[model samples]
Target: MKRICSIYKSPRKREMYLYVDKREALSRVPEGLLSVFGPPQHVFDLLLTPERTLAREDIHKVLANLEQQGYHLQMPPPEEEYIEHLPDELLRRNDPV
Candidate 1:
């Protein structure tokens, strides 16, 4: 049976639900899976799963789609130093348990 998860976004009170297979759920969950609450990107990032590269082209495509649908999104934040790929030596030293 496929277990569906419903995440309630507080302060906003938005409910988002997704149905995924068990294997996918196991691989994608963070240690505190039930407590996670945020946008899709934030949620996935907290889970420490591999993130899809959200490149400039992807942003442009999204803008285009939104405009076509008559939706105007707020300006994107300026790019700051985002560390994605860390050196193995660093991971080894930081490893817990």
Candidate 2:
């Protein structure tokens, strides 16, 4: 299956994103989720296909969510994951110079 998908970033949380069908937009996302997710900032639109690959999301799962629930939520990577990638300078900020 092929679909045009729109991606939105969460203003309240870094690295959190929401994906939905371009045609359906955000209408299908529930108010509860929207409240927690904050107002979505339009990021970009992409044409998705079975053969396509996404940097952070599973393409198949995203498409399935769009088909079934009309939306896909991409939560931020865990805090540990972020710590692991922190620059040495930042990690050493508390250390003596």
Count of steric clashes across candidates, in order: 0, 0
Could you give me the TM-score of model 1 versus the true structure?
0.18
lDDT by candidate, in order shown: 0.32, 0.94
Question: Candidate 1: lDDT of 13?
Answer: 25
Candidate 1, residues 1-97: lDDT per residue as tens digits? 1122222222222433222222344334343433443333223211111232233324344334333432212233454534443567578889996
TM-score between candidate 2 and the true structure: 0.82
In lDDT terms, which candidate is top? 2
Please, what's the RMSD in Å of model 2? 4.5
At residue 78, candidate 1 shows an lDDT of 51
Model 1: residues with Cα > 4 Å off, grouped in runs? 1-13, 37-97
Question: Quick one: how many clashes does candidate 2 have?
Answer: 0
Q: What TM-score does each of the candidates earn?
A: 0.18, 0.82
RMSD, one per candidate, in order: 16.5, 4.5
